[model samples]
Structure formats: C-alpha cells, structure tokens
Target: MELKVLYFGMIAEVTGCNEEIILLEPNSNVDQLENLLKDKYQNLQHLSFKVAIDKEISANDTLLNPNNEIALLPPFSGG
Candidate 1:
C-alpha cells in the first residue's frame, strides 16, 4: 500500500522534507514503517518522536492504511 507520511518540527529537519510518499506491504504497522524510515534516514534513529495516525497518537503496533493520515512528530513543549 502507498502511504503519505508527514514530517513535523525536528523530524522535518531530519528528513529534509515536510512530506513524502512511502510504499509498504499489505497489513503493515507503525513499527514496520518506523523501521523503513530509520533505514532510509539513518539520522532519524537518534531522535525521539511520536507517530500519529489519522490525527490520533498511535501505538507502535497500530495498523496503517493507505488512506490514513500519518505524521512523524517531534517532542513539543507547551507554555
């Protein structure tokens, strides 16, 4: 399945782009996506971030769909 991945804050800086299309196998989960991303962008392995699926914070084992809105978000502090 083809997924659109969005990079935010420090994650975007590391990726050097705000968003991109990723192709994954059927029934792929968040962990699998993270592995693929870490392989493609070695620098990402050193960063701490959260994965959001369809605007909700998702767990590592969360299943991904082609139509889901996926985002990589760096840690943020609120005032």
Candidate 2:
C-alpha cells in the first residue's frame, strides 16, 4: 500500500520535505511505518514525534489504511 505522510516542524526538517509517499505492506501498522521512516531518515531515530492518522493521534499498533492521512508531528508547547 502507498501512504502519504505529512511532516511538520522539526520532523519536516529532518525529512527534508513537507510530505512524501511511503510504500508499506498491505496490513502494516504505525510501528512498521515508523521503522521504515527511521531507516530511510536516520535523523528521525533521534527525534521525538507523534504519528497522527486522519487527524487523530494513533497508537504504535494502530492499523493503517490506504486512504488514511498520516502525519509526523514534532513536540509542541502552548501557554
């Protein structure tokens, strides 16, 4: 399956793009995707970020769908 991944903040800096397409197994989960990304972008392994699917924060084990919107978001703080 091909998934479109959006990158934000420092994550975008690490990826060198705001978004990109990633190919994964049909039944791949967030954890698998994370591993693939970390392998592709070594800097990501040293960063702390959250994976959001379709605008919602997803768990590591969450199943990913073909049409789901995936995003890598860096940590943030607000007053």
Candidate 3:
C-alpha cells in the first residue's frame, strides 16, 4: 500500500523534506511505519514526535491504508 506522509517542524528537518510517499506492506500499522522510518532516517530515532492519521492524532497503532494521510508532528511550543 502507498500512503502520503507529512513531516512537521523538527521532524521535517530530520527527514529533509516536508512530505513524501511511502510504500508499505498490506495491513501495516503505525508502529510498523514508525520503525521503518526510524530505520530509513537514523536521526529520527532520537527525536520524539506524534503520528497523525488522516489529520487526527493517533495514540495507538492504527492500521494504515493506501488512501491514508499520515503526518509526523513534532512537539509544539507556545510563546
């Protein structure tokens, strides 16, 4: 399955791009994707971020599909 992934803030800096297309195995979950990304981007392993599925923040390992829009959002800061 192919999905669109958006990177934000520090995550984007680590990834060196704001968004990209990722191909994953069928029935892949958020945890699996996270691990895959961590493997691809070694810098990501030390950073903390939240995974958003289709614009909503997801806390669990949600199943992903080809049409799913995923976002890697870094910690927020308020002035």
Candidate 4:
C-alpha cells in the first residue's frame, strides 16, 4: 500500500521535502510507518512530531491504508 505523507515546519526541514509517498506492506500501522521513516531518514529519529491520518491526529496503533492521507507535523505555537 502507498500513502501520501505531508511534512510540516521542522519536520519538513528534516525530511527535506514537503510531501512524499511511502510504500508499506499490507495491514501496516502507524507505528510501523514511524519506524520505517526513522530508519529511512535518520534526522526524524531525533525530532519531535505528531502523526495525522486523513487530517485527524492519530495514535501509534492507528491502522493505515492506501487511501488514507498521512502527515507529520511539528509542534505549533501561536497566540
């Protein structure tokens, strides 16, 4: 399965791109994708971020699918 992943703020800096497509095995979950990213992009392993699925914040156990849109967002600050 392939999912579209969006990167924001510092996460984008670490990834060196605003978005990309990640291919995963069938039935993969958020945790698996996170681990794969950490290995693929070493900088991500040391950065702090949140995962969102189809525009909703999700947990590590959240199941993933080819149709779901994923995003990695850095901490936000605003008044």
User: For each candidate, what is the lDDT?
Assistant: 0.97, 0.96, 0.92, 0.92
Candidate 4 residue 18 Cα shift, in angstroms, is 0.7
Give the local distance difference test score of model 1: 0.97
Write down the worst ten-residue block by lDDT for model 3: 59-68
**Tens digit of per-residue lDDT, candidate 4, span 1-79:** 8888999999888889999999999999999999999999998988888999999989999999989989998888799
TM-score versus the correct structure, for each prediction? 0.97, 0.97, 0.92, 0.93
Q: Which ranges of candidate 3 are over 4 A from the true structure? A: none
Per-residue lDDT for 12-75 in model 2, tens only?
9998999999999999999999999999999999999999999999999999988999999999
How far out, in Å, is residue 7 in model 1?
0.4
Candidate 3 lDDT by residue in tens digits, 1-79: 8889999999999999999999899999999999999999999999999999989998657999888889999998799
Question: Model 3 lDDT vs. the true structure?
Answer: 0.92
Clashes of each: 0, 0, 0, 0
| Descending-TM-score candidate ranking | 2, 1, 4, 3
Query: Between the candidate structures 1 and 4, which one is better when assessed by TM-score?
Result: 1
Q: Cα miss at 37, model 4 (Å)?
A: 0.5
